[model samples]
Target: MIISLSPRATLLETIPFPAVTVCNMNGAKKSVAEDIDQNQSNDSDSLFEKHMLRKLCRDNELMSGSKVNASWSKMQNFMVKVSQPCHTMLVACLWRSEEMPCHAMFNPEITDEGMCCSFNKVKRNFIYRNPRQLHGLNYTFPYPSIDWTPESGYPPDAPANANPWRVFGPGKGLGLTIVLDAELFDYYCSSTASVGFKVLLHSPVETPRVSEFAYFITPGDEARVEITPKISTTTPDLVNIPESKRRCVFTSERNLRFYRTYTQRNCELECQSNFTLQECKCVPFYLPKDSSTRICGTADDECVENVKDITEKRLPEDYKNRTGWEKPRNINCSCLPSCVQIFYTKQMSTGKLEDMFNVQKSFLGGKNLSYYKQNMAVVHFFFVENYFTSFEKGEIFGFTDFLSSTGGLLGLFLGFSFMSAAEIAYFVTIKVLFSKLRKNQRKENITQTRIFKSLPFAE
Candidate 1:
């Protein structure tokens, strides 16, 4: 008769971390490690090993530069829980609207003092000195010529009488003295008025793209510029606003009418100048209060309302039916499909640098920054049970299997040799026990026969 024997061995299988507890993504929870017995029951190990492994795992968090995996397990009667790692990040606007045109020259000097007339001497005298001084001083007379002044060609009287000009005094440098001398100004009373100015408008549009500019004219320093929308009639050149800087121009004109200085306020929202020639202010693009058109759907709407809506809506019913339906499933991928890219901790990668800048630009971005910062620490968990099972059950496979199996050849040889030695010891022990049993049986038989012969006489 032949006896068939079943060998006893251990096999391991890959299992996801069992459900232990539900951990809120926003909930603050401390990390913990657990040990299990051969039957997968909780067992305690020395504090040193657990502490060391945890420290090692933590130090190798992905954000910390190393990509090592950690471990987790489900509690028998409780819930298996883990922190959800934040993935979405933002890249902020690095460029700003630069050099917004402010004050400009409207009537740049053309044909010096054409309005001077012969009688303008009194006005020129007034322009050169105070009227009180002219009347008070003793007279020294050689009345200057009225017709075509040597240099200006117009009579000197023209400059004095001209509403825009005044005697500012010698050494102080002569200039047209008026309250309305903004870089660009319009006059309703004068004919043949020369109006030249450099107009610059602040834009939120990004660089490397062409955009249009709108011009508005207003009377005072109001927050809003009440502009009369004209087509090409009031259009300025479409200048290239460089990255992080504003556009500039040196413009001059001798004729302008029916226009007011394009005015703006220096307040918080409307500080960005609308028109005229002035130094440009480097303001950020798509500010919270900005009304300018933006490329990312109304420059103000960073998330594109559709994307915002998706994030705001509750999980769909169909999704809820899935194992992880209560929330969005965590799907981590990398440039390489075969590589298991695990998120180890909340960390900021180079990718997040741009996002930080974008968030700083707006109130919403500011609020979100805090959230991203808190969630940057994450940990990835991996189970080694499958590896151990594969090794024990001789089911090694995959790219790792080839190397592991090759490296484990020595262990396999040693294990087999140990088993063979044990078998030989067992066989020798069994033979000795069997031989002793036969010898005892023979001695018992002889004693029984001797007793039977001694009792024969009585029979």
Candidate 2:
């Protein structure tokens, strides 16, 4: 019988057979059909063996092990629950495994400072710190420059030998100091905020006499600040201004007329920890159990604004006792600066792996503690379990610490070996080169002395 195998078979399932033609002694078509049936069975056995080998290799520990591995059918079943921005390659492997926790790999990246992670976006911007009190939006500005030209020949009313300095006093405020047009400054702030981020503005230059600082808050948007030197005149009416014991107003030498200049003071505002963990139970927020934390009511607006206004009035002991000052600050025509921006729109959350996986527990030595503290602002959001400044202490308590003990020991050994070897090699190379050069110089000097003595005797 002549057997003809189809070329459409998969590589793993292909049967080992040669194509053949039946002779006229027997019906050629019937013989070919029998051979084709035999080859089909052979192909099935090859495919089954290949499938088993693949499964075994993928599951072997320390061979081809991963977090996710399973039979083909099991993997397909797990795919129904996959719905995040995490790596598809990981998901593809994970679908085969049914035992994996959804959040097994969702932990944050731990830096010296804290946990850093990229956000859930098609193109993710990595956040090194937790989103906290100091929120900011990214902004860009053109590189600034100033071009100066003197008027050719003085005007008819010019004082002879007059310098430009004579026209305006340095104290009079109009020399050649650079001041941002208020419109451009405010527009920058507003534009940054429009992209769903909080923004703070500080005057680029000091203007000494600013009574009411005028800057465009956004394009075509304007904001004014009023400054008063008198302590009793009332601190700038802004919401949630932290109270300070000193009432002295900071003064600078910039010569410009402004009623007030906005200064972006950096500070931390924290959510007070409640004795017990309750759902969204945060300071400056009311939680009555029935109302969702997200469902903040109209009364919340009044309370929040009051907290801001009252906090600014560093109420003296006497003022604190007074019933009248304790009452919420009245909001009228005066608009209070917003402490936080609120958006009512829903946004699709992008999913990403938390960055703190290996480093937090493993990476150590050097001034890592201080380095972490400096950059703590970047990744403080995820390791919110413990507020300790030290990661070593935090690790002991298991506050978002995910690194293995072995990784830490290995890292320390490698770090010490690298530094020690570098130092020893550097010293040895320097010593050997110096010694060889000194020996060569001594031989040359002796030869030159002998040659000079012989020349004199011959003369």
Candidate 3:
């Protein structure tokens, strides 16, 4: 009799098996089948080799299919959990608003002081004797002539240039330009107080960027400048957590009116200045000073403390209502943090240098001996991350992503596509709705027939 066998059955039957034998060595019996199984098990130790063996064995009972399938399943899971990587670039700068104190000295010949130049001699004495008193004062060399127009032209915006730098003995050394007076440079070198400057950062990309400048200095002689950068990030949703949570993301003005890139520190300083002006009708010497307002001196320490307490809301309830004391509007000064994280650190060093140069010839035709000494401070900025820009790897998956992955797997292994998904939806929704409608129609027809049959007269 002839018999037909299925493909799986044929495959199983075709799988080869080694012959078994019994042998004795040193009074110990060993089976040849056991030796063959041991060699096969050793060959199957590697996952790839095991998988190949299982495929080769087909439906053979000698291979465990579950183990090979599980290995591939684990690999697929690992690939699905991987994250994507990206990179970015950035640019930034530093700036300040408060004006530096400077003085211009006249040539002895022009002032007609002979051996003793009034402008140079007196100003030098005043600077060395009482530097604090010279904070907002402007001194012209030999005074300005009737026809003399201010060499430093007005800045385009006045509010930004409200407290313009005092350029001493200058030719167009005003506004943001450095003072050209040698004497003023000497004074800056000798001054014990640290100076402050504004820093601004600019970038072409749409990503948000911010920076902050911090330094250690004497507490009472602290520099007035405050550096704060805006917060920005590509992953806003992740960094900007709700009030109940937090994330790692952190979140400039022009010449006079700094560009909007000004940092939070800038806003706070400006707000404090405004508050001081409103309370004491003056600002501290370190802050911007105008003709309408005098600089706050040591004598105004009490008033300054009062204003600080009120503005910062540190005063008691009774003192809160003190006349002319109003809380500063911090809301208007609100600043946001950048989504991207940025940290900037600075190191500074100081040194002294000596040089000799010929001073301008005086009317006396004799050159006076002048000593040039300079004390300089250098600052270096570096990124803590050791890179100008950085990248973060993240994974964002949702229910839609899961469904898409499932559909992709189906298409890869079972030939399923969008059309197949649409057909399934149609069967579950449209077909089911139609079937329900037909069932209701049949029940209504049955009731109608029964009602008609019961109406004997109308039959």
Q: Pick the candidate with the highest lDDT.
A: 3
- Alpha carbon lDDT at 53, candidate 3: 29
- lDDT values for all models: 0.22, 0.22, 0.31
lDDT of 1: 0.22
Candidate 2: tens digits of C-alpha lDDT, residues 323-418? 434532322211221221111111111222233444332122122434333211110011111111110100121212333444455558665454
The prediction achieving the highest TM-score against the true structure is 3
- What local lDDT score does residue 60 receive in model 3, on the 0 to 100 scale? 35
Give per-residue CA lDDT, model 3, range 1-459, as digits (tens).
Answer: 111211211111111111001000001002321232345454333443334223222323534433332232232222122100000000011112223222232211100000111111222222222333322223343432221111112244423212221221211121121111122221211111342222222221111111122123221121222112122233333433342233222311122122122334433445556767776666753343333456553345557768666544545454547667554444243433333322222333333322243322221112123222221111222111111223331325545667888899999999999999899999999999999999999999999999988975843
Rate residue 195 of model 3 by lDDT.
28
Off by over 4 Å in 2: 1-264, 268-297, 316-459
lDDT tens digits by residue: candidate 1, 223-305: 11111111111112212222122111111221111111111111111222111101111212211111222212122222232
How does residue 443 of candidate 1 score in lDDT?
100
RMSD (CA, Å), each prediction: 40.4, 38.9, 37.4
Of candidate 1, the 10-residue stretch with the lowest lDDT total is 110-119
Q: How many residue pairs clash per model?
A: 40, 33, 39
